[model samples]
Target: MSASQAAEVVRMGVLGHVPPMSYRNAQGEFVGYSVDMARAVCQDLGWTCQWVPTSLATVADELKQGQLDVAAMSLLSTPERRSHMLFARPYYTSISAWVARPGVALEAPGTRVAVVQGSAQARFAQSRQWTLVEVKTHTELAQQLAQGRVDGLLAPMMTVVGLMAAQPLQSLQLQVQPRRDPELTGAASFGISPMRPELKPLIDGALERLERNGVYDKINSRYLPFKVN
Candidate 1:
């Protein structure tokens, strides 16, 4: 569309947590794979978009309240989540891993583990019968591992990778659980708010084209070392 048609700005809600996906960088700008992908979608659709940084808990509320048109924070399309919001084609898949300090053999069922607040890791940890500790933020999760408050942190692999890159914890080891399968793997889609049915296909179309043209990989690989597809 021409500039006149792009006059209206799209409001997108993004994650303020979760590195390599979406997070406020040291420069205070919200930049990551998810952010860049959303920007590309908006650009392809000829819409000017404003990214609003939000947490996982509030992003759904923001979308429900009609304050945001899209929530592009590597959102998993679970049954509960699909009840109200719509999802565009998945841009990336999320995988879970266990991060532990050095010399900590945490492969047993009763090992103590920490999870970020309101994360899918909680359910997996519970399923394994591991003792659980909940931290509200990524930094707190790291602190728990460092202080020996927990044996390890069960978090997203991308997040664990980012942590390992930023601060090379000498003892930190990111390991995949033995039982990891469908339950532990989920697609991370760009969630759309309801009442804007027209926007879904437009974003999806843009995403399809971006992926076909290899733009998606470039954007994704910029923040994450591995391809999540």
Candidate 2:
């Protein structure tokens, strides 16, 4: 391939801390359900894939600034976000839940809730006028909940479950409220940079092909206990 052609490969950004979905491992490699799916899509299109590790707090800005070609992290489609970037076809269903110690009133006035910055849960907390303890990553959000620094945590249900099984949190007996917030429940899709409008069709087609060929299901099963699509 020519230098210009090689340079045209997609620069996909992924969260560095959200495990089982998209994260950078201990070995410094990006591996997770989202990463696998992105790779499959790029491979199908015969496009080189360059993975960029990023935090959820900055991904949207990065995309809007053209610093990244695609946001491969589990980004939920929202009207507010749609104004900043384009989203590919929906890949998975996203639902968020509240986690807290038993007997803690999550809906009480001035209840401090921890939420990952730039996430849908954060917006939900803000909309409800809940005191927000904004965090940059899922690991920090989990740490705040485990350390009792926050009254509750509002995050994706699957992410909450994954973090609960990790260190510094596994022993804590936390109550997970059922997901019911319409703002936090919706289809998650890849956020394509507005600068790369051409990527929308390419990524959408690749994802559709993967789904039809069962590759999407295989990747989903490899990382999650339940199907997200």
Candidate 3:
């Protein structure tokens, strides 16, 4: 491809602001740390970014079908993902936790935990044997909890915290356990189809540069307190 062709702008898919990571505002404009980083990398590559926005429920299929060159949406690099895509080294790390109503807490064996399908938390719920209620959107999960349809939710801590901040209610409470096993509680890395092996190296290099230049922290700080090591 010629330079112009290479810079012709690539399409990226986003799970549209489910919190702390990526989301769309009332104007239908995208804003989030992940989107910024993706844009920065595309800029560095002399390429333009065309966002192919969709719900988190269908992002995986979108990537698989070549509808997107990369997923700007935050996704874990699991064996299942590896079977289909390449991934950059992790640019961020966060722990998983459960959210419940203010007076209700999660208990084992009988708990009904709502998790977003295809998310790491879904697998965690299965492993723990929690009766799973899979949902397409975080908003749906939160609504379920509010309506007492589910007992709790499982997701990255900062995301749940951001959700509670954005929609304050006495019924929502996030419980975090920092010491859980990595497989069950920790996630990092972004998913990219292996077709663009070249893009993988480029993205990895760009991430390194972002970290060195403190760009990552700047974007991340907008939503979460990354400084709290």
Candidate 4:
């Protein structure tokens, strides 16, 4: 943008959370794959992005309350959310895994599982009829696993693995069960407000271009060590 264009730029809030996807760096700047992706789209659309760093609790509310224009938290495209939000083409995909203390049966009767509230894992846990310990974020999930408060946790594989690698749990012998995803949420994407419907195609076009130009691949490689799909 030119000096004069910067003066008239449309400043919009873009929300994000989590590591590798969106989080504050050592310099306290919001930096991650999702952040870069959002910035790319914003630049392409000739807008100035102000990142709204949000937690699991306030992310949805920030969008609903009109405080944010885009939620770049790798949100899964759901039919229910589609009723009011416009989801861009998926920028990432994820799979679920069952992490548990040793000797606990994952699919057994009366198994206790911790899951993020309102996440796909929560829905999966509900379908299995297990006791649920609903948490608001991945940190809480990792804490629950470390504390032995739940027999197991259902969560995204990479996030949980990263947590385990960073935090060494003691006296809490652990086991991990990798389950074949049963259509349990895949292909997460950025969410745009339905109020700004016109921006969807422009954002989508930028994403398509980014993918074609290897920008998406470069961004993905910087964060994720393996191919999600």
Which prediction has the highest lDDT against the true structure? 2
lDDT of 2 by residue, 62-81 (tens): 99999999998778888878
1-229 per-residue lDDT for model 3 (tens digits): 3587465677787767566678887898887777877877777677788888776556666666667778886666666666766777676666777677555556568789888888777876778857899988876777777777888877776567666766543444544443255765444666676666667877788788878887777777776765521
Quick one: ranking by lDDT, best first? 2, 1, 3, 4
Higher-scoring candidate on lDDT, 1 or 2? 2
lDDT of each: 0.75, 0.86, 0.71, 0.70
lDDT (tens digit, per residue) of candidate 1 on 1-229 = 6666477588888777667777888888888888899889887878888878666656666776687888977776665567768998998778777777556666677788988655667656767777889777665677777777888887777777666665535455544443255666888888898867778888989999999989888997787667776
Error of 3 at 36 (Å): 1.4
Tens-digit per-residue lDDT, 1-229, candidate 4: 4565344333244333355666667888887777888887777656677666565445555555556667776776656556646787888776778888778888787788888886667767887769999987776787887777888888777666555665644345678777667646588777777766666776788888888888888877887787653
The worst-scoring run of ten residues by lDDT in candidate 2 lies at: 1-10
lDDT of 2 at 111: 94
Deviating ranges (above 4 Å) for candidate 1: 2-5, 102-110, 168-179
Residue 53 lDDT in candidate 2: 81
Q: Estimate each model's TM-score.
A: 0.85, 0.94, 0.88, 0.83
What is the TM-score (0 to 1) of candidate 2?
A: 0.94
Clashing residue pairs for model 1: 102-171
**Cα distance off (Å), candidate 4, residue 176:** 3.1
Determine the C-alpha RMSD for candidate 2 after optimal superposition of all C-alphas. Answer: 2.0
TM-score, candidate 4, is 0.83
**Model 2 spans with C-alpha error above 4 angstroms:** 1-7
Winner by TM-score: 2
